[model samples]
Target: MGGSDSRCLRCGSTKSREVRIFDDPQSLSEAVAASNMPKEIADELEKRISSYNLRLQKPHSAESHSSQHVAAMMDATGDDGQLTLSSLSRSLERMDIHGTTAEKLIGQAEFEGRLIREGQDTWSWLQQSS
Candidate 1:
C-alpha cells in the first residue's frame, strides 16, 4: 500500500477505489445506500445512474444468460471488436450480455465508424482492418 487514499474492505489493502455498481435499479439503490452519502448528494447522483433495462429486457420473461453469447462476443471481437456478420452470429444462440454493455461495445465499434448491421442478427466491421 503506497498511501491511504483508498482501502479494500475485504482484504484491508490500500490503493483500491470505490467502484460504482450500476447494473440495475436494485444494485444501484444498494450502492447508493452503502455510499453513506447525504440526501442531496444521493439525489444528485441518482440522476446520473445508467440503467440497462432496455437492452436485455424481455417483454414477457426474465432476461436469459447464455454462455453461447459470451462465446459469440469472443468470436466477433476476435480478441478485438472487428467482426463479420457470419462470425458474429455463428456463435450467438442468444444475446444476453447486459444490454447497455452490448450496446456500448456495438456503439463504440460503430462510433469508431466501422459497425455495419446487415439484418436483425447480422453485422460486420466496415472500415476494413486498420
Candidate 2:
C-alpha cells in the first residue's frame, strides 16, 4: 500500500506523529503495564494517568459550582459592592455556565436571599446574619 497522508489541513504542514487512543484510564494503564517500556518511565506514566483519573472522578455539584461563582463575583464587586447582571453573566460564561443554567443560578441566588436587586440590572450581595 502507498504511504498514508501526513498533511495537516489547518496548518498546511506535512509533519505527523503517532497518536494513541484509549477508551479510559483503566485501559491505558493496562496497556502501559503490558508494555516493555522502562520501569521508571512506566511508573511516571501510571502516576500521571492515576492523577488524571482522580480529577475525572471528582464530584462537582451544580450548587457547589454556583456557590463558588457567587463567591468570586462577590470578591470582584466594586467599591459600591454591587454585582451587575451583565458582569454575572460574563463570569458565568467564563466558567462555562450559560443559558438556562445561568438564569437559574441567578434566580436561586435571589431566592436564597444571597442577592438583593438594587436596580434593573444590578444586585447587592446580602451578608448572612451571624
Candidate 3:
C-alpha cells in the first residue's frame, strides 16, 4: 500500500485520499461524513454533523479583535477619564485576552492615538463622541 492508490478498501474511494479513520466516535463521524464511505458509521454521526454544520454556519471575522479589547477596557474606565495599567489588565482578563497580546494591543492603541499614555503605568482613552 506504498503507492498513491493505497486507500482503505472497505471505506471506498468516495472520501479524499487524505482522510483517516479516527478512534473517537465524534472525529470518526466527521470523517465518515466527509468520506465517500457509506453513511452507516454510526447514528451519532448525525448529531455530530448537525453540530459541525451549526458551527460552520456562524459568522466569522478577520477584523481587528484588538478593537474589542480596547472597547472593553474603555467601557471599564471611570468617569474621570483615567485608565490604569492594572485596570486595563483586568479588562483584558475579562475579555479573555492573553497578557502579551493584550500588551501589544495596548501599545498599538497608544500608537494609533486611540489611547494616550499618561504616566509610566497609566493610560487614558481618547473618547470620541459620535
Candidate 4:
C-alpha cells in the first residue's frame, strides 16, 4: 500500500486517485454520484451536500446580519462603481464573515440583483431606478 496506490484496509479495494475541485453543490453532488466510494460514505456526503445547498438557497431573513452586510457592501461601491471579489471578501472578513458564510452572502447579493457581474471576479452595484 504505497502513498499513491493505497488500498482500503477494510475491503482491500484500491482507493481513488483522482483529485476533484467542486465549486458548487451541483458539481459536488455529481462527483459523489459518479464516485466508486463506499455506499455509506457517499450517501452521507450526499446528505450533507443537500443540506448545505438548501441552506444556501433559503432567503435571508429581514433581521439577518448577512443582509445588512450585503447592503453595506452595495452602498460602499468603489469610485468606479465596481466591486471586486477580493474587496468583497475583505469587507466581509472585517464584518466577521468568512469562508462559506461570506460566499453565501455574496451569492445571495448577486441573486437578489443587488450586484451585477461585470467580469470573472468583478461586479457593479445594481442601482435601483427611481
Where is model 1 more than 4 Å wrong at Cα? Answer: 1-74, 77-100
Query: What local lDDT score does residue 48 receive in model 2, on the 0 to 100 scale?
Result: 100
For lDDT, candidate 1 versus 2, the one ahead is: 2
Listed per candidate, the RMSD to the true structure in angstroms reads 18.6, 15.2, 13.2, 16.8
Lowest-sum lDDT 10-residue window in model 1 = 59-68
Error of 3 at 61 (Å): 3.0
Residue pairs with colliding backbones in model 2 are none
lDDT of each: 0.56, 0.73, 0.70, 0.72
Q: Can you write out model 2's per-residue Cα lDDT over 38-92, one digit (the tens) per residue?
A: 8898789889999988777656555566567676576546688887767766766
Model 3: colliding residue pairs = 14-36, 15-36
Off by over 4 Å in 4: 1-64, 98-100
Q: Which stretches of candidate 2 lie above 4 Å from their native place?
A: 1-60, 98-102
How many residue pairs clash per model?
1, 0, 2, 0
In what order do the candidates fall by lDDT, top score first? 2, 4, 3, 1
Error of 4 at 19 (Å): 73
Report model 3's TM-score to 2 decimal places. 0.45
What TM-score do all the candidates reach, one by one?
A: 0.26, 0.44, 0.45, 0.43
Query: What's the CA error at residue 105 for candidate 2, in Å?
Result: 2.2
**Per-residue lDDT of 42-68 in model 4, one digit per residue for the tens?**
789889999998887666543576666
TM-score ranking, best first: 3, 2, 4, 1
The positional error of residue 35 in candidate 1, measured at the CA in angstroms, is: 34
> Model 2 misses residue 61 by how many Å?
2.3
Q: What TM-score does structure 4 among the candidates reach? A: 0.43
Model 4 scores worst on lDDT over the 10 consecutive residues at: 97-106
